[model samples]
Target: MLSTSHTVRRATSALLALSTSLLALALSAPASAEVIVRGTEGAPLHEARPAPGAIFPDEHIVVAQPSPSEVDPSFLGPVLLMKSAHIDLEKGTMTVPLRKGRLESGELVWSVLTDVTDENLANLHGINYSAKLAYGLIGKATRSARIEKDGTFVFASGKVDFKPEHAVTPGDAPNFFPPKSAQPGAIGDADYSPLVQFENGKNAVFNMPMVAFDASEETLNAMCDGAVDKTVVHDKVTAICPRDGTVTLQMTLGYTFGKPIFYLSTEANDPVVATLEGAILTPALNDTPFALEDAAPGESAERIYVFVNGPTGIDHPFRQGVNSALSDGGHGPLNVLGGIPTINLDYSPIWRLFPVLWTEEAIEKGWRTKLTNAIDIENAGAKGIVVSIAGGPPQAVGFLVNCPVVYRIN
Candidate 1:
């Protein structure tokens, strides 16, 4: 379990790449039950810019609240629905990690308006682009909501009033978290990222380009519209909406997942073919090992085999079977510990200096192919897969965000 020390130790090579001492035991399960604590500590709401010509209403949203029932959805759709009073740009720059995303689909609606003069009631723009964003979600997502111009971000959650078009019911595009709740599932454990390109205002994009309007206003308004910044969801969550109303646009951005890249050396000696697939992790295989001298009396005394990760149906078998040559009759590919006995990922600063478990440098090189497929490995020694096999594939192996980083101290 993500909560157990044993689980904190072994698992997928790619998952091991995400491991950090700061990673709480909270990551024990794939779909952890909803955990709701009182008080809004991390949930900070930012005020919304008043809709076009509308005056700021006093009690627009007298009661602002994130419904007790939160909604965690996958990274899809045009905009990310949120309930915020006022987002602190300082916070966004200070604590915000570099979020990644990409553009997947949708047309960019760009337009220029011939309306809107000092005292004239004319407001129309030109050109607009609808950029569908696909991403590996990063920060905490806002859920079931009822917002106001007062900049109130609230999650008015209930049994989940879902409509067909709403992004949290049946048929809604898949995203990072589930529906009607913010209990922190893989949305926190996993990475909802999309491939990115340097084009927009900030850094990179997920995988697609944002809907850019040649005129500007059209793009800006569409961004703040419900179509763009109106929802946050995950896999378990579909579309949901008890009602609807029309509104103008504001500002926006989108995302997508990029292709994975790495190099591999096969038995055919094919010049280490470069492969592009999902994300990669070092010590590719579970049963894989590194240390020249296998730990004595079994390394189990330290409570091992804690966590696991990676894609399905991939085990290079470097830790055991015929693919292994690290003595102990284990698999070969994944470079387990910091020892010269085995070859983990082709590149790793940790492998060169430390005598520990895993490192980021190694996994970034695409070594998940050598994962040790199993449920648990208690006192399993360096023989066969050294990683602990908890239950099975469904619960273990997963995409990038689902996979975690791992580490061990000497």
Candidate 2:
């Protein structure tokens, strides 16, 4: 759980993201849940512009020139939703359907958008593509699910408890190194995980958010309408509506390959890590490891880049200000999410936090502050300019987080 002040700020942000009717209802209610509305953070979204193009004769060559219009979703362009989900950029809220399914034991499984297995479904959902999902087919990394006659998902396993109260108390000022107490609001059972390998002959594992367990649709809808306690929703859930069959969640701001991005923080294997990322602490995920190299065959893991000596302060052009070795009192190093698409492509909700430590010599020579590109930072490590914090007490603790990339800011 966030401090009271943080909660208030988050609530205020959520209130601002909602419509007037919702706002009025919130005022009438003693308390209302909040969401972390995104979109306008880090940098402004640029208008789509036409790129210069050149035409080549078919007889000579058929080359497709790079067009500005070819930009990916986020700062690139609008994403088409195959599902009934709606993303409102102005409100920084994405209202996606409150998808429901069931477990083999007849336990209810509730979920939400956006990732899927099929490429066609990906286009329809406006989600990222992950061919690696095929690898999850025969592993402990994925849970099994089947589709019912009415299109409801029936899972073989996986259940979550949204009742836990989340709270986190950062370490005393200066450098909030280790939080005093950290508790994730929601928790999952031994069988629960986001990676779902549908037994419906689908070859892809649908990496989506599992929002609830064994909860009736009617109860969820009532919670959405504020007729009942909203705690039934995850702490990260900002708003929910059964009428619209949509649930709005909060997103965290970060950078991916030097580009500002937003992603959903859902679960973390470590409690402290969960608190820091505003995610649920799913001990069930303890089955996963910190590095993919150590994972069992077919196990899924993606790298989440972090800098140990990046520039500090909010004004620096490349300022992430997450250098743990530095003494600026800023806590939690800036986390880089996902891979550089088309380069070393592997995008999944599952992530392994990888830290880049600037060598003392490099720090002495002042070589680690302003760098931003992922390749450049890794290259610095390869060149002995920096090193991994392996085999020693780290400047900052590293842990895994399940944060699905949502969109880019700039």
Candidate 3:
């Protein structure tokens, strides 16, 4: 559930801080002199991708034998493991059980359960369907698996390390999408937009990390070639997939902003304004509604759609990031270039008189804002966001207030 309350956010922040500190201390401790789970090791994975329909290869299946057991505490993502996997070659595509068709791209896309339950003791926790998985590159991240049935259980044992290179081509199947029938560039209705929303209040901050964008041309660079510009960087290994392309980009973001708030725009050239304008959202579209339309020479219209990172301005106990960009021209830390209309309290005087002034107030509040939008986004479902820029006189006013810069949830 989404929360935008002051107290709720503050408590969460405290918990996060404490957890981070503890993790730091633990990592600094010596390695555990213990044998965790023992089981057959997985193959070495270099690069692989999921077939359009032949995905989610590994399921929590039942086994006649108990897997291994973990001796140390580790995170397990999704319990689902692909019975099949796919690999790439210079020729065409290498078919794997988990893979259905061609694999020409230089990337892999596994619906990796980012983190899993820490059931290291003698006890076992049933599969959690609510756990979220991400499709991306490999990491040291570990997950545990086991066989489950109505009457029996077998622990798959050991922590499963993610490795795209471990994917091997498997036998062919009748259901595999033949190269002749595949839609190369037609991504029909794939969701590529990754968004970040914030919930703020008097003493709370809810930060959602920004995933790779599946929308624009730059998104493609992020997926396949891996590009980093002044705006956003994929320094962290985030699974990037284009809405249209055949291969998925298993990569880490090279850059990041000061906060969770980022810019969003239809245009790619427009400068990004570091202001907490509104929540990043992606309205549903059967086909990408806003394509890259061209502009005439010397025309200042349609420059670029930039999203500066900041907070999601949800209304309820005074959110800071939801302030008017005109209020301070985004002289604040948490801001987005592709800004959105957050605060409905668009009082005429405040906007017309002192746009910069509002920005200062937003800054002094310490990067807090929340937008209340009721889209059909599921808890962990992929979503998008949009922001609108202010025009006319506000541009001349410069900035309102310079507030403390907030950190993004890296």
Using TM-score as the measure, the top candidate is 2
Model 2 C-alpha lDDT per residue in residues 127-186, reported as the tens digit of each score: 656655555454345677788778888888777777777776655544334556777777
lDDT of 1 at 253: 9
lDDT of 3: 0.21
Candidate 2 residues lying further than 4 Å off, grouped into runs, are 1-67, 70-85, 88-91, 222-230, 286-299, 308-334, 340-344, 357-371, 383-386, 391-398
User: What TM-scores do the predictions have?
Assistant: 0.18, 0.69, 0.18
Q: CA lDDT of each candidate?
A: 0.19, 0.57, 0.21
Candidate 3 residues 313-361, lDDT tens each? 2222332232322222222222222111111111000010011112333
Q: Which window of ten consecutive residues has the lowest lDDT sum in model 2? A: 54-63
RMSD of each: 25.9, 17.1, 24.9
Residue 294, candidate 3: Cα error in Å is 45
Q: Which rank order by TM-score, best down to worst?
A: 2, 3, 1
* Candidate with more favorable, higher TM-score: 2 or 3: 2
Model 3 CA deviation exceeding 4 Å by range: 1-280, 283-321, 331-410
lDDT of 2 at 317: 40
